[model samples]
Target: MDEVSKNNVIDFDKEINLLRSRECFNETGFLLLRGIITQEKIKKLRSRLEIIFDGSSRLSASIFDFVAEDNFLSLVSNEKINRVLKQLLGKSLRIYPNLTARKATFSPWHVDDAFSGNKVVNNESNSQFIQVSMFLQDNHYKYGGGIDVIPKSHLEETWQIQEQSLSESLEIFRRVRNKSVNIDSVAGDVVIWDGRLLHRSSPKLTEGGVDKYSLMWTVSSIQSNHKEFLTHLENRGKLKESIENRLYDARYQELTHIKRSDFSNFFLEKIKKLDINLTLKDSS
Candidate 1:
């Protein structure tokens, strides 16, 4: 597909206006856009991801690394998504560089803000931010581990659970009587939801399990000026101390074994092939 043809920008103003009128968002706090990404692009990205996954020493390490990597970042910052974000959040949209990849296991019901140390504003009349995710593969209902959202749940008052009671969060899943939508999306389907939405991954019912690959990006309006330092701390705290320690311990080992310069050259070549205009000049 031609670059121009591939860049399918959605009308954000119309979408937002429609969402405001519909109680669907207020009731579920989430919305899905099926097949937002093109099939060809998805195939190319998935192929690159498979190669990266095979070579990476620590697949479960800091999610930020994956977000920062050129292959992933390019897809997340696609022109279509950027256009929508510019309309929704204005010109100065800052993307949080953390891409979460949930493997075979079910995630407990929780708000994105739960891990952030900052308190959630209890205002349904206003929107602070929106979270967008692109699925890299199909997450069928039978295969499971797909995201299950409680619509408009974000409008409710915020509640806190003690750190020790984290396991109890799973109970919310049982109460999800509403028909849960499985995001059995093709490689390029994009899903966007309000940041305050209550969502969790459904259990991966299949015995062998599936790798649920997804990239998440957060878009905040320039006015919000949300704090980032505290957010990072909260994310760090969510990981087990032992796992965090091991990741740190293995970081240097992985870096030493791989030639940073060679990786840089590879990315530079790939960027040239993609014909992307990089604002910052590469010193190398």
Candidate 2:
């Protein structure tokens, strides 16, 4: 083939892969990028995370935006993560304040969009909001623990999706569980999911083993969906007065979804626009 033709094929292939990744996420509302970070990076972050936990009782299994140190913040700027995010959230991806670190925590089946079943039906422009989670262990039967998701279940919305009983949610899950996926990821793997997707913590199949450690953050391109989800989060946060008016609040609070996405963006955005300290700490 001619030099020009060869170059064209290579460029075309690259463009196609980019489009395919975003297309898949639009349909499924989640993307699992295998080994997106190095194991060494995961180890360092895990060590620091362990220190942050300071050997607290395993009973809690979570820390709310505990630390925004540089190492934890750098994961978001990882090249592979940026690439996928650019495809999904456009070039203007703005991260919401707060980073959450967790160890072996579990949450029941739920949606982050105010528990609304159909508010996020349109995954086009509204797909700007996404959660990026990095797991520090292999998700296998023996190792156990990962996230389970309902495929395409994010494409619906109601002002509020009534909470379902465990048995009831399970019954519904059982009916369409075949269409869902339990992300079987490994250490250093990254899972980026839409805010509206129905998901829950995958259980540890074995009785004993080191627990899983994960770091998560939320980012979004300006879109209408952000407004809806934020309103839902703020109201829930106010229910328990979990909303922290401070830029870098450190209290443990459960305000629906990941507490990182808990505050109203109006609140976060106001702080962000001021070029306050909420932006990622420069790793440079």
| The best candidate in terms of lDDT | 2
TM-score of each: 0.65, 0.71
lDDT scores for all predictions? 0.50, 0.59
**Candidate 1 C-alpha lDDT tens digits along 63-181:** 53553466666654566565555554556554433334422335566676532224544354445567787776666656653466665466764534323245467455455546345
* Pairs of residues clashing in candidate 1: 26-152, 27-151, 27-152, 28-151, 28-152, 29-151, 29-152
TM-score, cand. 2 vs. native:
0.71
Would you list the clashing residue pairs of candidate 2?
117-156, 117-157, 118-156, 118-157, 118-158, 119-157
Give the residue spans of candidate 2 off by over 4 A.
Answer: 1-16, 58-67, 115-126, 156-164, 225-228, 241-284
lDDT accuracy of residue 61 in candidate 1: 34
